[model samples]
Target: MSLLAHGNSILEVEVTNISTHGVWLFAHGEELFMSYDDFPWFREVAVKSIVNVEEQSPDHFYWPDLDVDLTREIIKHPERFPLKSKSR
Candidate 1:
């Protein structure tokens, strides 16, 4: 037997993993990695702060626990954005 999405779509973002290098997130059917090199805020934060995640919009993500927010594109291609800790 197989399960379906039913009436509502699951459009939520979540922090899947946290490693010495960085963090992993599962969202929009994709697993995105955020390296501490690029996103330094998560390097020293508590595990609870890292795990809390929310998808405010289709392409936007928000982490209320740590007051951190990011976009799906940025998470995928961080090199494009040169300035670190940029204002989002």
Candidate 2:
């Protein structure tokens, strides 16, 4: 499925792979791995829970399911947000 943002702006995220553990999202010409271990809300849930993802801008992503959002900069440089934890 496709993801749309405010003003119907289309996000570039794509589901490259899905398994019982989690989903792999491809965006911004890069591959991002997300696991249920860290994102507990997605555990045992279907892929449809993704609902939608909004780019919002060039670097941010908004996920309606987990009620969570993030940005490319943060994913690329997670050290900046030391308080945050990555999936094990």
> Which is the leading candidate under TM-score?
1
Could you tell me the lDDT of residue 45 within candidate 2? 53
- The lDDT values for all models are 0.80, 0.63
Candidate 2, number of clashes: 0
Worst 10 residues of 1 by lDDT: 1-10
For candidate 1, write residues 1-88 as lDDT tens digits.
0112676556477778899999998876799999999998788888988877777778698878778879999889999976777422
Regions of model 2 farther than 4 Å from truth: 1-11, 73-88
List clashing residue pairs in candidate 2.
Answer: none
What is candidate 2's CA lDDT for residue 43? 57
- TM-score of predicted structure 1: 0.80
Worst lDDT run of 10 residues, candidate 2, spans 79-88
Name model 1 segments beyond 4 Å from true: 1-11, 86-88
Per-prediction TM-score:
0.80, 0.60
